[model samples]
Target chain A: MTSSHLVYLIALPLFSSAFLILMGRKADKWGHIFATLISAAVFGVGVSEFMAMHSRAGDMRAVTQHLFSWISVGTFQVDASLLLDQLSICFVLLISGVGTLIHIYSIAYMSHDKDRRRFFAYLNFFIAAMLLLVLGDSYLNLYVGWEGVGLASYLLIGFWNQKPTYATAAKKAFVANRVGDVGLSLAIMIAFAQFGSVTFDGVKAGVHGASPAALTALGAMLLLAAAGKSAQFPLQSWLGDAMAGPTPVSALIHAATMVTAGVYLITRSNFIFDGSSTARLLVVIVGGITLLFGALIGTAKDDIKKALAASTMSQIGYMILASGLGPVGYAIAIMHLLTHGFFKAGMFLGAGSVMHGMDDEVNMRRYGAIGKVMPITFATFGLGYLAIIGVPPFAGFYSKDKIIEIAFNAGGTKGIILGGATLLGAAITAFYMTRLMVMTFAGSKRWDDKAHPHESPVLMWLPMVVLAIGSVATGFLFNSGNSLVNWLAPVLNPNNVESGSELMKPIVVSSLALLAVILGVALAVTKYRTVPVEAPEDVSIFTKVARRDLLQDAFNETVLMRPGQILTAGLVKTDYFAIDGLVRLIGAVVSGTSTFLRRIQNGYVRSYALIMVIGALALIATIWVVTL
Target chain B: MDISNYLYLSAILFTIGAIGVVVRRNAIVVFMCVELMLNAANLAFVTFSRINGNLDGQVASFFTMVVAACEVVVGLAIIVTMYRSRRSASVDDASLLKR
Candidate 1:
């Protein structure tokens, strides 16, 4: 296949989404199946393209397809083009591959929903947008895809918008994403100003000529955009609330596509980040903070999907943190991303399966020992759990341990601090994930008599089983010979060489990471081995704060929303009084003067004659005066 | 006679007619005063033509005499209708347009 087929990778899902939506309720019975088939078809296309690329050598692996001239001006030009390269191929497979599985799962999960067709349409739209995001060759072209995914995410999150809170959650996510989008816009503008072009190739070639200050600014702005999309730190309050969406949506956003966009953006812009150590350090710090932030929140969440969402945030944090570690960390971050996509998506689908059996009850406190009833969900979800905790031979072990190794090998005090943080994040991740497992599957049954936990249909568990297999195998396979790293070197680090000495050996790092996981697991098992049906009312201040999402919303309201509200109110008052008052004053003066002048029109003939005679006398007097 | 003296007599007659038209309330009186003013203007035109030894002013006086004749016909008719409608000849009775 030629590179021109790249367009179909995006267009197929996009047009199918549009078609299903336009067909409306008439296609309800088969709309979901049609959507699934389209997703699978897109995946097939991506696989064929991958096979074609694999047959080629180093320089030829990356291919570009130019569709048309997008924008042109004096010395400024852009093309609507697509790039199917090593880095994007990984994302393509993950998005469409995991996306297809989620689609299959949704067929059964959403079968009872009357608007299931609309849900599939949104899912297809999300897949198309995500594909565009990775395949776009330039920052400007990528923006279209960025916004596309944001819209899809908003629509899917609010799919059950009859509930007011669900609608509000969607709005929150959209607003937060807008904040990040501003960063992307600014970064693109900076790139254009500095390099005179916005294409990835152009920017990479020009980066050597650009000043460090400009590069740092560009890098910082890109990171800001990543932070928004990936739910890192201050911009991340929406991820937990976003769980108000359906379970498949959570899996798609957290595991497969939407949140991983941040990692893709940073890695794609590796040239800029490499030039700016300040920006790189900032990315690492944000990643470090958010990993802990999400892990802490995960430990306190009662809702099962929300807990998984928190873990997704923390896992992305590891990827972001790893990407920030410079050349050595980029491939490792993507490896973790791919693995996280598998395990996290599988776990979320498993959660959905559990929900399907338990009347959509989301509280883990209310869910205990349902694993006995739903064996496939339990087994698949357990495999994912093991993978997430970085247990040996699992996907997370290879990827996450590599990130931990890289962090420690960064050298000096920086390495020590970053290494410590990753280690701590690993421990907390283990604790929260173990707590989730024990509460949902290990403890005594906490549900009421009305609840009957049963296995989901074959359609639902099949996808989970496949992803669970991925979680158990993908990390080892990708790490066996550093194949993923070597494959991505042309894009991430063309002059690749091992430059640094290790502060901690890979074996040491693995041991420490495993120890941390064991410690966290032991604590969680001992503490939550017997969870009460009802959560205790009196908790420590830390638990209380964590339970409330660490006051992120409160901080935003006080620091951002309140000031914005005040400013808007002041502007409104000024417009009403100052601007409008001036117009009102002008009108009043004209009307008042007209009223005063109107009194002279008395209807008496004698008075009119007297005035006319006086006017004639005055005219004669004026003539005499002028002559004299 | 000198033409200046004729002009002064015409101006005095015109002023008197104007005062009569403004002060008198009777519609018939006002009509007669307007005719007087028009004739005074025609007298001034004849005097000016004699002084200048030109036919232009004489032709103008003839034109004024024609217009005055037409005015008298229309003005007298309007005054008759006003008297018939209001049962009074006062020009003040037709002041409805003041406001």
Candidate 2:
């Protein structure tokens, strides 16, 4: 296929977004269908592009579509271009394919809303932006897509803007992302200064010759950017609150597509990370800490979406940690990323289905024995849960377990620490996820009288079922022949590292992971299966802190927010009392002088003539004095 | 016959016209005094032309005369309109600009 066809992948959604927005409420009747069709067409184009690239031999698998000269200065140039390579192709398929499903899901999820058309428009906009992000040839172009998705996410998260808290949540997400964006912007600037190019290929080729310190700086800054987008540690406070958005938004932007941009970025820039051990270790550290942090918070969240949101953060943390493990970890990170997309989106959609049946109620404590009422949701959510906890034969097992095995093989004290952390993360993941499942589906009925639980429409359950199947089978398929790893070999593992290294036997790792899962499940089932419906008012300090997201809010307040508030207040005072007062003083001086000067006019021709004569005399006297 | 004498006579007439413009209350009288200043400037221009042995100053005086005639037309029209409105010709009485 010609590289020009790549435009269709980006243009389809962009055009649909423009169409939906321009048509406004007039297209409400058919907007969702139009958006879904456009997304499906984009997915078809993505599949065809993948096939075309696959048919090509070796390096030719990567194609660049040069649109125009974007920027040009002496010895510096960037093109408006798109690259259809093995790595980007994966993202394109994931975004468009999964995006189409979410679009279909949103149709049913948002059907009752008055502004559903606008929501669909924003979804299309998001897909277009995400497509731009993965497909862009340069860092600058990618940034365009990056900010585009940010705006789209901001719009989607506040889709129900009538709620003040929802709007605030949207603002919070946007602001947190902006913090990371600054890091990305600086990274690009430093990259240009160091290598004189911001193109992915240019940087990858040039990065090896660069100073290790520079490479480490680049990698660290990139990690910060990833942390913001993927909701990693320190920047994670926004993800749980982002649950205030519509469920489809949580499923698509938060769980599936947008959040994975960070993983894609680190994986795309693998060359830089490969060169700098310090940078790689930093990536691992961020990932490791965030995984534990998110999982701990997940264990305490009562809101179903927020629980899933925390789970999403922890899962992304795993992917980030994996990406930090060097070449072997990059491929595995992407593998986990793809599988996580399927299962997380499925699980979030399942959460939406429950809320739909339970009169939009979100508290998991209020949900019980829902499995009997909505078997499809329970079954899909159960598959996703099993996948997430790394149960054998499920998608997460192949991807996540590989990461753990690789972490163990990383060697010495660091390896053991990383491995142990990942294992602990896994057990905690299984525990919290199991608690969520039991509290939501398996226990005695705790639903209020008003909620009449029922199966969602076929439209909603259909996507969940598809994603659930993906959650079950994708891991085995991808890991079995090393097909995914091989397909991605040209871009990700150019040296073709043999994919068989385990510090411990494969059976041992799998057994250990399975043991953790079983123990977690057993612990949760015993504790929560017969527990009271309402959350107990009194809890341990740890639980309280975890419930408050490990005091992240208070920390943010003390560290970032409070100082910002005080600084703003100080500036406001200075503006009012000092700067503004000075301005007022100048105004008073001018007015007072003008009032005094007004007497000189006196409204008489004789006075004006006399003043002009006196001014002329003064000028003449000055000139005469100077001449003398 | 000496050019300096004409320059001195022009300067004295210009000063007298300036004082008349400043002291006079009647708009017609002030207008006449402004014309006198223009004539005085014309005299000085002619004297400078003779002293410098050039026709440039004489040419400038002609241009000034044309401009002064245009200014008279515009100024008299404004004065006539103001007089018609307020029924007064004294320069002090036409001080509608006083705040």
Candidate 3:
């Protein structure tokens, strides 16, 4: 039963996919229902697991369900075990819970689409992959999940392959992901060679004896992998372009599951991150840098989903920053993870509703004022907005507030700067989100004749409503000592747990931050409201710098994207000349050799046998003479 | 003839036949030359078995002759097919075998 549970996280979707595919032509038509039910059941399993673990809070150790031994030859062995520890359990719950909501949301969002069954299939596979990612107790299994999500992201991003941009966007994602995969594969090899183990438990238990130099090298390489996966710094620009996918795909896989895999990987291997001070510092600095960059870019983005994509990057930055801090790191990190999931899902779905109505147009300037038209979407969107900007009584407020407090109390100027930057980033998040809300839902309808705005179907709205309720209420439930982390505490080391700021500091700082959020919303209310102002065609200078997507666009365009194009072009030209010339030379040589060989083949058998005898005698004489 | 000397002579003869098969252009000649090499090797085996006072080697040589005869039959059938198709017995013209 235990072994089967581990494979269930991986095989169930795969098994169902076979069934769904065999049922083929009809399977896709009814696929969304089965897919959604499967994910929801997985969520039920996660919740039940949490409760089961909760009921047994007296246990101090983790749950190690050994599925089987994956590899064992000589001294090397890696298990196919599934671990239920404090960290994995927290993410298992988050992935399944949020995954179900996204699946349900997709039901109606994709209801009207052609090839809807294929969409459901990809979505189900993605959930299974993400589950495997959190559940796998070994590096090899985790890598499978990592690549699985990458494959899913590519498929979903290019779901509408007819659109050249979507296909290109998918290509860009796959290529950029390959760069990160190289770093991850390299680090895996290094860990295997140095520590002789790739399993989580083996690596954690054994790596303490490894040379600090090797540890630092391995840590830096892992950080590089994490950066590319999490969309920090150099790779941050791809997520913005990844918005070329469907709105729901942009919401779940791109914004939530796929992008966060990097952070999750780093957090899961905290023993490595915590051991190397240099590596932890690198995580904080890169995370802080990416956060500041993502927030600023979001402020200047015009497309609602694009802006939200930028916002997701910035929010993930806070979580990455949490991984760099002390014992409290995992709790604060997962808080941001959960809250961000709810609000970001809401925001993207809300964008979908607007796009649904406006014939899929995402320009903010062209949209204005329709709160009454989409009361459910707007209200849920509003609640989501408050949660995102860290308004009081909303989920983001508590989580973001805790992370910021942890950052400040981390006791350095760097900590203070990160805290302040995170706070200001929240304000900007509010500014952009309010700008979005006011532009889309606050005024009279400004849609063109081809566009007729209407409410999304029940399937879409139901998830929005559900996420809205979670966004509004989850923070309170967490704050009352009934937090998700408490549920996770049974499998953790008590000494390392954050016990999360039972002090006045978090309250004071958070209340002030909430006030700042309101002020931001107030500013947006004043500015974007109908003054008949023409929006700037070019960003104002400071905002333009921000809009260069934190110089990520600039970096990638210069270092990666543009260079790649040039190298490809150069290779094409080289192939035309060098390869063609070489091939022609080979052709000339072959003709020359064939004619020469043909000359030797005059057909006298007696002469050929005489030549053969003479040649053999001469060879024997030559060998005997040389030795003498 | 003493078996050891006869074996060496047969080996040399077989080497000559193989060379002829490789260097000759006429398909019929190359086919006959390959058969000569197989016969020469079989002769060596039969002579060595008589010298060693053993019947097993002679038996193996007998089986080898049967296998070689079958190969010749199959090889001739293929060559005849090619000859019929193209009306030529030039081995170089039959370029289908990449090797």
Candidate 2 lDDT score at position A26: 92
Which scores greater on TM-score, model 1 or model 2? 1
Residue-wise C-alpha lDDT for candidate 3, range A1-628, written one tens digit per residue = 2323545655677666556656777776678788878877777777776676666645543566777788889998877778776677667777777778888888878878877888888887888888788788888878888888888888998999899988998888888787888878888888898888888777787677877777777777777777777787666767888888889898888766778888788877777765787888787887787887788888777788888998898889888888777446666776777778888888788899888878888987677776777889999999998888888879888888887777776666766787787778777778888887888787766767677788888888888898888888877777677466665444323454544434337677787677778887888889877724345756578876766676765777888779899999999989988998799899999999999987656654445556776888899999999999
Candidate 2 off by > 4 Å: A497-502, A597-628, B1-99
Q: Candidate 2 on A500-560: residue-level lDDT in tens? A: 4457887898788888888888888888868577788798999999999999989999999
**Whole-model lDDT for model 2 versus the true structure?**
0.92
* By DockQ: ranked, best first: 2, 1, 3
DockQ of every candidate:
0.46, 0.58, 0.03
What residue pairs clash in candidate 3, if any at all? Answer: A28-A117, A369-A443
When just chain B is superposed on the true chain B, each candidate scores a TM-score of 0.93, 0.93, 0.88
Better of 1 and 2 by lDDT: 1
lDDT of 1 by residue, A435-476 (tens): 999999988999999999999999999999999999999998
Q: In order, what lDDT does every prediction score?
A: 0.93, 0.92, 0.78
C-alpha displacement of A609 in model 3, angstroms? 19
List clash counts for every candidate, in order.
0, 0, 2
As a whole number from 0 to 100, the lDDT of residue A490 in candidate 2 is 81
C-alpha TM-scores of all predictions: 0.92, 0.84, 0.78
Give candidate 3 regions above 4 Å deviation: A1-4, A58-61, A485-494, A497-504, A531-535, A545-551, A565-628, B1-99
